[model samples]
Target: PGQVDFYARFSPSPLSMKQFLDFGSVNACEKTSFMFLRRELPVRLANIMKEISLLPDNLLRTPSVQLVQSWYIQSLQELLDFKDKSAEDAKTIYEFTDTVIRIRNRHNDVIPTMAQGVTEYKESFGVDPVTSQNVQYFLDRFYMSRISIRMLLNQHSLLFGGKGSPSYRKHIGSINPNCDVVEVIKDGYENARRLCDLYYVNSPELELEELNAVSPGQTIQVVYVPSHLYHMVFELFKNAMRAT
Candidate 1:
């Protein structure tokens, strides 16, 4: 009950793509960005921990789940430990940024870790359709939240952590205001194709078709994180390749 109340006190803020681009591009590594993350990430991390805790005991007991839970707990604690530190000092800000980067790197294997946990659960105790559906629903939300958190961390790190400049002119942090959809999709397909080729004797080719006709030279673009778009496209193509 106490844990539930603590979790309830911090509501995760909804961030739009525009907001991410605007704030990240303009405030990259600035005091505003530092303070915003300092205040925001702890809440988000805490909420994630709460959600993980609420998973059914059998699933939670899986080694991967337990490991992930520990990571979250440690990350949250580290954030809280730095919460009271002033972001005004340059050294302190640098240290805090380093901490955030470390935390982000620690979660690099989260998707595979969660997938392993699910596999373990399935091998141990078969899931009924209703239970499987419920688990899937939870996983969908969990992965979405994970993406959002990683976006926040990655944007900050790329913009403020001395990484190279944005690859495109319209990019702000990790988001491009005018992301070329076809280019991103092709990049994803290439990656997936490579992976498929490694595993199968015959890998399929990707043919691009323009579903919506544009003017002679106009290209479809949207504001998005290129890596996120790449990841989604890669997953789709990977599944399609498997089916083939």
Candidate 2:
């Protein structure tokens, strides 16, 4: 009954990069952001849970898959419990921030967990192209939502002193108005190179001469989340290294 009621009231809103940047300040906008996340997270989690539930029985039975489902269920329940609380009071906001932090920490293993599940499924039943495509689609959406959820949570937590204070100028929560793309790429390459070297005897060096040209002097800056760009670049580098 509670689940049904909660879903009825809150539908997930379309969150875009522009919208996130626009509200990336530590002012009255934060309250609106907090309230939006407070309402939106549970609905997103519920949708993820529903999609996971619809996966094939064999896949669902995988231990990692089960664990992921349990995490989602637990997170959803926690958010639902806090659903009606007003974000108006400092105490309530602080408590909610704590809850967000807890939930964020709990989902840290989500990527590897889902990957393990896919490995287990493939090992047992072999790959069915149609089924694989469906699973891939689900995973893509799931991770995208996870990214958005974490961004929202981190933005709120940063604004509310969950971590060190958000940057006073040019930063709204995690979004950096002048994020340097080349610097992020270098960071990603270094990280990926470190792992590659550890796993393989010969790791290819990343050549970023072109990127470095415009990197200095903040010549190429975008209104974006640096960590998100780093994640994408890291994966690309990792894949390229593996192929090399």
Candidate 3:
């Protein structure tokens, strides 16, 4: 019920939102082997079915809308595929949840780049400044929609993916100055340097170790979103790492 409620809150349209709550409306309801299982099964399964049934309606929509719809379609397909094949074991469930998080991460990595590319294309080819500005209205709406999707996926990954889930790591760590901010910070630094080298031709040394470590008297753990913190720190590292 909680999961279904979350979906309702995150759903794009309040009018169609009830489609997620009403399991009886799911198409091909005859496919389930037992009537009881169909009725008693997790509401999440029904929600996935609902999403699968509705996504096709967006096919003729704008390119950005289509991209988001396609992603949801594929993500739900993966969930269904995993549910059908797994034995409901802990390991199997973990792997399925991991795959879902990976899908969300991939979208996070791709969509921003896509938004930027589209924006750049419009500016480069637009006839006039006003025209480019006008086009930005639609682009802004498109990206806002994508951002909402990401936020929901991120929340879902954390709430349901459990302790071992990568999404859970985002909110359990503390500042690196403590020497115990976990290995993600180390990897983040390396990736930041690599990115700087690729773009700036000269990479600067990331003296992360020299930064003030959290004192023992202070709190050892800081609760926050890992991706948000990492991105900000990584960008700062890139700028500081650059050679003057």
Which candidate ranks first by TM-score, i.e. highest? 1
In TM-score terms, candidate 3 sits at 0.42
Error of 3 at 135 (Å): 5.0
True-structure RMSD, every candidate: 2.5, 3.2, 11.5
User: What stretches of model 2 exceed 4 Å from their correct place?
Assistant: 1-11, 26-30, 165-170, 203-205, 209-218
Worst 10 residues of 2 by lDDT: 210-219
Positional deviation of 71 in candidate 1, in angstroms?
A: 0.4
Ordered by lDDT, highest first, the candidates read 1, 2, 3
Q: After superposition, how far is residue 239 of candidate 2 from its true place, in Å?
A: 1.8
Clashing pairs in 1: none
Q: RMSD of model 2, in Å?
A: 3.2
Model 1 ranges with Cα > 4 A deviation: 1-7, 165-170, 197-200, 203-205, 211-216
The alpha-carbon deviation from the true structure for residue 192 of candidate 3, after best TM-score superposition, in angstroms, is 1.9
Q: lDDT of each model, Cα atoms only?
A: 0.81, 0.79, 0.47
